[model samples]
Target: MLKPWFALCALFLTLGAIAEPSPRQMALFNNNCVQCHLRPGVGAPLVGKAQDWQTRKAQGEDALLRHVVEGLKGMPPLGYCSACSEADFRALIRFMAGMPAGTGQ
Candidate 1:
């Protein structure tokens, strides 16, 4: 009874995870960026909306990474992902900006 329900819930969670980031990246975003990113009018870019990221994207990955590392406007230093590596930030930025892979420029 309860075992079957738990199993079904686990299956859905696994599927959801599979459709997106690796578990580590997902965990980082969940704990850090999700606080402002998924919300409206928080002054941080909204995930999955390209327009929210276009101007920033045009600045190139290096600039964006610097902003994340150094803090800019509404973003705090390290964008609050203190545990995130440069590689993690890169991938997550592209994902939020909707840029095609390797096209962060």
Candidate 2:
């Protein structure tokens, strides 16, 4: 029983580790998202504003990704980060939407 419990704990720990973003991802977010998301009335949802992101989150991750990739409203295509990959977009969206990493999609 103890062996099984330890295995479960290890698995959970590994999963948690994998859920975090890399340093490059952090840089990408700081360089790109912070410019608009941290401000008000920029047409981008302010980071950490649950109410602002709630409606958008309800639209699902796929729809959000599409909007980001194609540009929606005042947001630019690829969210202005041409180097950002799909995973990067997902991580940034989760961060901005106030969802825990790996919880989006």
lDDT of 1 by residue, 17-97 (tens): 322445788669767887788668989987766688889889987898899899998999997888999888887776666
Model 2 C-alpha lDDT versus the unseen true structure: 0.73
What are the C-alpha RMSDs, in order, of all predicted structures? 7.0, 11.0
Residue 60 lDDT in candidate 1: 85
Model 1 pairs whose backbones collide: none
Name the regions of candidate 2 deviating beyond 4 angstroms. 1-19
**What C-alpha lDDT do the candidate models reach, one value each?**
0.72, 0.73
Candidate 2: pairs in clash: none
Q: How many backbone clashes does candidate 2 have?
A: 0
RMSD of 2: 11.0
- Expressed as tens digits, the lDDT of each residue in 1-105 for candidate 2 is 254335435533644543455679767876776677766878788766668989998998889889999998799898789889999998877666756666644
Task: Give residue 85's lDDT in candidate 2 (0 to 100).
Answer: 95
